[model samples]
Target: MPLIVFCGIPGSGKTTRALQIKEYLEQKHKCQVVHLNEEILQMEKKEVYKDFQAEKFARGFLRSNVEKNIAGNTVVILDSLNYIKGYRYELFCLARAAQTQHCVIYCECDPQLAKENNSKNANNFTEEMLADYNNRLEIPIPKNRWDSPLFHLRSKEETPFEEIANVLLYQAKKSKDPVSTAPEIKFEINFLQELDLRVQSVIDELVQKQQESIQSNVITFSDCTEKLMINKQISLIELKKIKQEYLKITKHNPPKRIEDIKNFFIIYLQKVVERF
Candidate 1:
């Protein structure tokens, strides 16, 4: 079973769709469904959304649960306000690292309807948060690989239950034969130096190509699967900065295979580059 995340404004039927999918999987498919949310987490939604520290703790808690329950025969449905695009990317990476499938189910509705629904329920949530919903939202775009396999369920529309099951279940089962090392990566002290050197070489090559093409807007790594699309002017200094940040992110957790240094770095570069 794969990880299915729900995202939308408050009262946008995220919880509703999550429960529906959970029931659908359990009854229709006879699979164990882990419905992870505030109730299961034993945390108040108000507390989780009240401030930064609280939200961080809550997100970390849910993330841990998702990581643990992502595997096995359980279908993990995370019911939350996953309005943060970066957070969704983190989920995507987790899925990639796990060698599992993941999808985003975005519940859409009129903001006014959402606000009114939230108020009527008034489940310990403040009225002030309603207005911030749209501002806080980082809408998911399907073209973004991280946000791919996305589903949009507006009010009154039935969720694509079979389609959802097909992607996470049938497709996943079809490709489960490969050995997955993402959960158990190992490396040595010398490996760290090699990783640093490998990343720097990639930077050197990219900068060289940039200069060779007289600073072409687009640069491609023929050896790597990742694609880097420049939306604006990029410089050597900026490329170095991106490399450093990428290293920092992977410092404690390098690529699953040492040989994949270039591929992993290029993938990360595209992600960071696209943000600009």
Candidate 2:
């Protein structure tokens, strides 16, 4: 499997190039393509790209979708204005973790041309929004590891279809090996017991502090130099919810050593509590 990401400003023909590649892959290589587009997912542009938090949520949702679907004879195509380098890096990491190769197809076009095209289509992107996006755009650099294997398409006709298809298909068809995954890690019974005990102790301490009407306090986790800081009033329900999330995260990728468990949990608490 391979992930082909299309990134550009509105009206740069990202969707067109994505669909072109999708057709070529399907017809030539018999590849099953997963075309991911904001329109396809029924997301409102004004809502999703409204603010930092909204964009972050949208990106997280798209990343989760890629992670969930990138398996078994599928060629994933993410079509969007992926103008942020940091977000592109996250996608690269996700592809690596899934044991698949990925590439970016940047659709380069004149700002005026893009604006005209968008207006002709009656797209949601306003002139101000498009200009802001252009100003904020971090063009892909081939020197960066994540941005390597990048292709440029100034127009639909300029798409590097053959080269892209070759890169994505060669290893996929050549290798019969299954997707590589990290070996399952087993936590010892003693370590598990301690984990539960310490987690409960943390919850009780925080709940007691809340009951006592403490607005802010620093709580120490055992055997760690770092401390947990609670700056806002948190309810028991919220605390329990955070606990469940912590458990879920730890379950997937547990601390390598039992000694590190307390530190890990404390760090996790600091992050989750800071939002409250």
Candidate 3:
């Protein structure tokens, strides 16, 4: 249930960090992992944000895809600019609605380095766009509602993958998924809790950091069901189990808050264990 979102400009080492996290999570935790950049975009053949139409289309699709992936064994790591504040908030809402646990890793690099990396990449974005992003980018001040766990990597030398690994390992410890190979699933829970607290500490953090400019965009659970059926990703039996077991666990009393989501998942996992 770990949804790790990376936000940075085109050449800010977001993809690099994301790959590092993916490698560590898979190698250290032995948990099934999915790289959203590779899977959701390149492999899944999904469109990405470029203009208004493309960005809207991709954002909607990305949100749904992230939620779906969380229902599986793989912990999904989403790599994107996620530059828009409201868009980031929407992600928070989606994860909460799905009862999935999440963390945010903000990758920041020197503008010089960012520009250099952008120029080096064959498919790198336009300089104008990168310049605009850097100009207008509002760094996320800690906020409770988002439950964002931030790691500021400042080294121009390298991304301190080892330090980031320590933080992830801690969070994994807190997750305490017995089968999770992540070194600190249980510890991450603590780290995340602390991060959330820091976000809450700032008064009017919501307004100060709110991503409210965007319109409401939501994909219903019904939509998810349709997609699953059409795609045939899960068996009919598994679908039935998800419904029956989710209903049994939720007790018709749906989750109202992010924390309640933990119980919903615990129930889901319990059902899986029982079946085996």
Best by TM-score: 1
lDDT of 3 by residue, 57-135 (tens): 6666666688788766677888877765545655665554444566667777788889998787665767777887788
Candidate that would win on lDDT: 1
lDDT of each: 0.77, 0.75, 0.55
Residue runs of model 1 more than 4 Å from their true location after superposition: 122-124, 180-276
lDDT per residue as tens, model 2, 157-270: 577778998778786455334546545657787866777667767778667767777555776645576577666677878878877876766665565566666666666666
lDDT score for residue 116 of model 3: 95
Clashing pairs in 1: none
The Cα error of candidate 1 at residue 272, in Å, is: 13
How displaced is residue 253 in candidate 1, in Å?
Answer: 13
Error of 3 at 171 (Å): 5.2
TM-score winner, 1 or 2: 1
Give per-residue CA lDDT, model 1, range 108-195, as digits (tens): 8898788777776646367677667668898888976667789988888988999999998888777555564333445686888888
Worst 10 residues of 3 by lDDT: 223-232
**Sort order, TM-score high to low:** 1, 2, 3
